[model samples]
Target: MGTVISRFLDALRFWFAAIRDVLLPRGCAGCDKPDEVLCASCTRLFRHVYRKMLPGDVGRCYGCSWYQGAVRHAILDWKDHGDEECDRPFALVLADLALKILERQIPCDQARALSLVAAPSSVASMHRRGRWQTLPLTRLMARRLNDHGFSALARPVLKLEGVQGKSVQAAGAQSRSRRIEGHVHVTEDLRGDDSLFIVVDDIVTTGATMGQCISALRAAGARDVIGLALACTPNRDE
Candidate 1:
């Protein structure tokens, strides 16, 4: 009964949001343009580029490139603004990146053995936004990857601690200066000891959050962990 009520409520809420978008028609969050979540030109701007993870890069685990430009903005809006319309676009970007990783990094057999793991948002953030952004993004990406002949599953493996803001500079400093402290908790036993797991997030800035997640997964006995983000702010070398 409770699950049914919850599902009904969610459907009602989505209906209301759809109505709101139809009536209000807000501009794009990325470029502030009219009539779209993201403009076509803006969408074209998101490019997948390789970025070297610094020594001890955490959020995106081993080596991965964060998607940038319009892709980043779309993710932020969906994540921060609770817009469901952005899911397809965000998933498209994630799928593209996943395909590239499969082709380039791991051997063909190893790529076939990997699965997608989504980082859970902090409880506070979910309460405020009313959704788990990473899960949706990961599921969408997984679907696309599956279509392209890669074995994939969305595993919610890491849970975040409550929301607490730290100085961006401080977080970045910690990522570069020292090891990340507390941030993630693993809740499940992942399958296949040899399988590579890629952790996905919407955005990564200081990498402190990702590092914490990686540490927890590593502690939980995950053999290999990789971090992937829709967008990342280049670390400021202080």
Candidate 2:
């Protein structure tokens, strides 16, 4: 009953925000600059790409920017504060990162398709956000890849089970890792098991979630899985 009421309230909030937007236009999500969802200056901040290798032979993860200052504020607004308009700009940056990685993996004349897998949102998060945050970005990315002559498929086959509370509620890396353990698994309905997968996330913190995503994909028979985040936590101890 509580969950039902919570979802109801979230739905109400969603509609209210939509109505408000139609009534009074808002400014940029990264800053209060007028007439843009993301201004040029703010958009450039996402180009601060950084890479981190996973613990094992598992492939590396790339982040467009360190999660701090403007980047952190922008992500929080987009992810938690209902700034849906930021989706495209964020998608553009993520797609750029994916393309850069692809260049190194394959020759310019050779076009290779990859599976763009979005990190699964928990049921609670879906209810709260009234949408899957990463799904839109992933979909747009696949489209952008195809437009650029690379075949790509958006695969949202992973599902989160038995997880509760917001990721922010997790106390530390150990706590986050423990809570998510055994909770992420691939849905049996996914196709093309042998395709390379690029796990798409809005942010990478502690790297616990990305690691779990790779594990779940590998267990489901994926031959390769890498990660790309819009940003990653700066000075993350874990």
Candidate 3:
């Protein structure tokens, strides 16, 4: 059966990873601690919620940690490099972040399903990476939230078109916003969507991209929209 095959493949992957770890002897993605994907000290850094301001009336954005030092290294390893093993841990951190945000924002009595929207990836980036990286993180985060008694689902409805270079390479807020302007689009008609849309991204430098994503969703008739990132660059004002 398909279920049997899936379990078998899962087990196979585990054993293969174990064997590879024994042979290759890798280190923590964050600190290079031997035989660990992400050491406890580094993971503890991701447990805290850091708030950053979004442009205009898009409201605040939440991040799991500040994008600096070990946090930045670990994210770059997982994001740019081929460290796929960091996905589950990063997803859990993001899920914890969502719960923390919802605890303060939404009351228990007033419950609604959550739609986890992965930030759009440009075609060039996807082609270079060979995958839609943010999509998997959003999917895993949704699963984690569902396990914690929330109606959560992953919705990859956003798209990026006509984007050149990368957001990180852009200098300031204005340049980044201008580069992403008119490029972030909603794939389907969300005219009657009532779910709380949580946009997930790997990083929030100036929050321009996150703001743009929120704007696109709002334009497509998505009412309740917010942003969450795995990590965010330091804000001196905040």
* Candidate lDDT values, in order: 0.66, 0.81, 0.88
RMSDs, each prediction? Answer: 4.0, 5.1, 3.4
Q: Please give, for residues 1-238, the per-residue lDDT of candidate 1 as tens digits.
A: 9999999999998898889878998887667799876677766654464453533635233322344555556665776667778777767766786677667764456355565778766576677777777788788887887787777788887876644533233345454223335657788765446666778866666566666676777778888877777676665541
Single out the weakest 10-residue window by summed lDDT for candidate 2. Answer: 104-113
Work out the TM-score per prediction: 0.78, 0.84, 0.88
**Candidate 2 per-residue C-alpha lDDT over 60-176 given as tens digits, one digit per residue, 9 for 90 to 100:** 689898887777888889888888888899999999988887777533443456889999888888888889899999999998888888778888988888887475534565676
Better of 1 and 2 by TM-score: 2
What does candidate 3's lDDT look like per residue over 46-145, in tens digits? Answer: 9988889987878889999998999999998887887898999999999999998888865432258899999998887788777878999999999999
Clashing pairs in 3: none
Q: Rank the candidates by TM-score, best first.
A: 3, 2, 1
**Deviation in angstroms for 187 in model 2?**
0.9
- In model 1, residue pairs whose N, Cα or C atoms come closer than 3 Å (at least 3 residues apart or on different chains), thus clashing, are 59-210, 59-211, 60-227, 61-227
